[model samples]
Target: MIFDPSPIELPSSYEKVETTGHVFVSHYPPGTPAVTPVVIVTLNRPAKHNAFTPQMVRDFEKLFPMFDVDERVKVVVLTGAGKTFCAGADLEIGFGVGKDRTADHRDGGGRVALAIHRCRKPTIVAMQGSAVGVGMTMTLPAIIRIGYEKGKYGFVFGRRGIVLESCSSYFLPRLVGHSNASYLVSTGGVFPPTSKHFGDLFNEILPDASQVLPRALELATEIAENVSPASSYLNRALMWRDTGSAEAAHLIESRVINHMFGSEDQKEGVAAFFEKRKPNFKANLDDNPPPSVPWWTEIDTGRSPKAKGPSKL
Candidate 1:
């Protein structure tokens, strides 16, 4: 069932000026203070084609962690404010033209990408219109991506004389295979999301642009209402954070499965099945993560050594 995913004012301003999506709560929980289950995050720069900016990057850096920990946010939907999703990075000030040393500089878009990936809630990207360059790459981390049928999309970095950012190096190849990634990046050509080159990059490409956000909200609502948040997050982690060997995979899976089997969601799910009613799975990822949750060596992406100036040296 589809929901009217209109923006209701948050208790406080979860909305930042730039960076992450302009957050909107769709449904309020009955009684006693739960905000909403699903949220729509809009890329608010419609005039400049929703182009990415430095402040936007900083906003996302803060926004995603809030989503990650907020028990109220079970699923997230990312969309743009207007016709075009994002044209790419706003180069009016020029890209990464910062005073920071190259060695210490982290790609801002990549930082946002990492934050999104670490968020345990199921995320959906609503590509309401065309997207380009980092605009397109940023959403690759989402579990589901819904695109407009006519929207033009591209890797676009080669044309700009830059390389891929937003950790697309890791996600794009895995989502669409090395060959597809190579073709998109090597050519740097804009193509429809329906192009043979995209593979399964877009989970669904709708017939019209107007349909994108609604469909994304529908999917988000589905996951928020019925699916077990802990189970869903673990499943995504198992795929994205793979163990090298089959035996290792089996061991981790066994451990997780055993733990999940005894979890509250499992009992609720089983009871709902027997009772013929919808299961209200109360497990929040922040409150209770599955055993061996990280299961992979956590990288310190934020660690930047203080660079000695030439004068100091």
Candidate 2:
């Protein structure tokens, strides 16, 4: 069935990313531009609290570039299927620890998280449920974060016994300040929704989920009609670099992933996923790879270790 992009008020250029029952690219459409804005990425796994698997992350990596390159796409909105935005990492699979179902699927999650943060276009994340782990990391990088009253926004890595791996260690402090970020990160799990105080993290928090899409589209359309796309993108990146923790995130992700790949947890994780059982990870992340630098301090302003150079545009 051909889905109509009209309800969300997209332009003719909007194209749907074929949803072939894969987690990576769900409800993505070709980038379209018009006076009205388009909704590109929709989280489909609501039953699972939109928990991300390796496939979902890969799809995000593939699609984010389309939005960035498509001059027409003015604003990108990210939301979940039913109740929650995303549940963060899949605890059972150990966050993309499954067998190499596809040759490239191994690191799809990290690539996807990187793409979301690096996208040049303005992004809006309308949260309604738990945004955990990579979910929280991905959300913080967006230009605008809109949380519904019923939505739960979480940074919850501390509880999992892993330092923030998904570039959040960089952006969270900048979005909410070091003390606030420290408190939230250290505390772990669901955060209190104080619209006034945490308002800095979100552009606005709606009273309920009903208001989320309309408000996001309205703002997207305003920007599409009025703002210069190039300037807007550049400005977004500056904030990402200066205020947000893009650089530090780059380092942390690289550092952590390298160590993780060599660990017993990763091996157990992969084996367990294929075995259809929960991974019995034994090694402590802290013990293997000592905590390095927080995003706010010890800045590394080099191109991402993963990025060799810009792909030929």
Best by TM-score: 1
- After superposition on all C-alphas, the RMSD of every candidate to the true structure, in Å, is 9.5, 18.0
Where does model 1 exceed 4 Å of error? 1-34, 302-313
Encode model 2's per-residue lDDT on 1-313: one tens digit a residue.
3232211221233344444333422222333233223544777777788777766765675566656545445578877778777787778778544556755442434466567776667787777655777777877667787777766677777888867765666677878888878777788857646533354887787787888867877776666555545445544543454434667556655654564565665676577778986444334211333243222343232122222222222
Residue-level lDDT of model 1, residues 69-116, one tens digit each, is: 565678888888889998998888578566789899888779878878
Candidate 1 steric clashes: 1
Candidate topping lDDT: 1
